[model samples]
Target: MITKWEVLSLIWASGVAYTAPRILNRWSLITTCDPIELCQGCRDERRYVMQEGMTYEVMGAAGGPLQVLVEAFAWYLKPFLPALRRAAGRPPLPTCSKGSCLAHTSTRRRA
Candidate 1:
């Protein structure tokens, strides 16, 4: 039979186990920088850093870039994205890699 102390310890251990991964993931998000020259994917990852950086630089009496307010808005639109991406004639936005923005040639959508 588990004693009260054992149950408490188990709860403590469980909480630690659960939070460790999440904390580490957040830490990675906070520190990593965009190595890909043309990739702006850093914008989202850097959001984690923005909050941790000097508050004055982010939003202070002097004023600066606003804390991201689009996270929830983007989440809400996720379900409708497929339908919204469709257009009769407009081409897809160019995709890029480390140094290349693949825009000069027509990109074909995969079947």
Candidate 2:
């Protein structure tokens, strides 16, 4: 048998336990950034680190160990995302139609 006060206390404790780490992590990131003196590389690195950290925190909070592992694996592949996007954005290979190649047709028109 559980009392209402016991349930409330458990809820409060869980909330604090979850929230304190997030707050501290955010504070650490904020304090490390020196807006005026930071270089572009430093800023980019910091941003990436912060994003990865936040991703882990959110994912860990939302699910069990397997979900956290999956999220981390996905996050590890994030750097390849831009390259994948660029490759996806490219036009399809030229196809021949009516004795004229599509690539050749476009080049001839541009000349």
Q: Which segments of model 1 are wrong by more than 4 Å?
A: 34-111
Model 2, total clashes? 0
How well does each candidate superpose onto the true structure, as a TM-score?
A: 0.31, 0.32
Query: Which predicted model would earn the best TM-score?
Result: 2
Q: lDDT score, residue 44, model 2?
A: 50
lDDT of 2 by residue, 4-108 (tens): 999977776666556555444433543365633444443454465566666567656554343334434444345686667678996433222313333323335
lDDT of 1 by residue, 3-104 (tens): 999997777666655555544453344345343321443443455455644564645643322323223223345466555666444443323332342211
- RMSD in angstroms, all models? 12.6, 20.8
In model 1, what are the clashing residue pairs, if there are any? none
Top of the candidates by lDDT: 2
Model 1 lowest lDDT segment of ten: 102-111
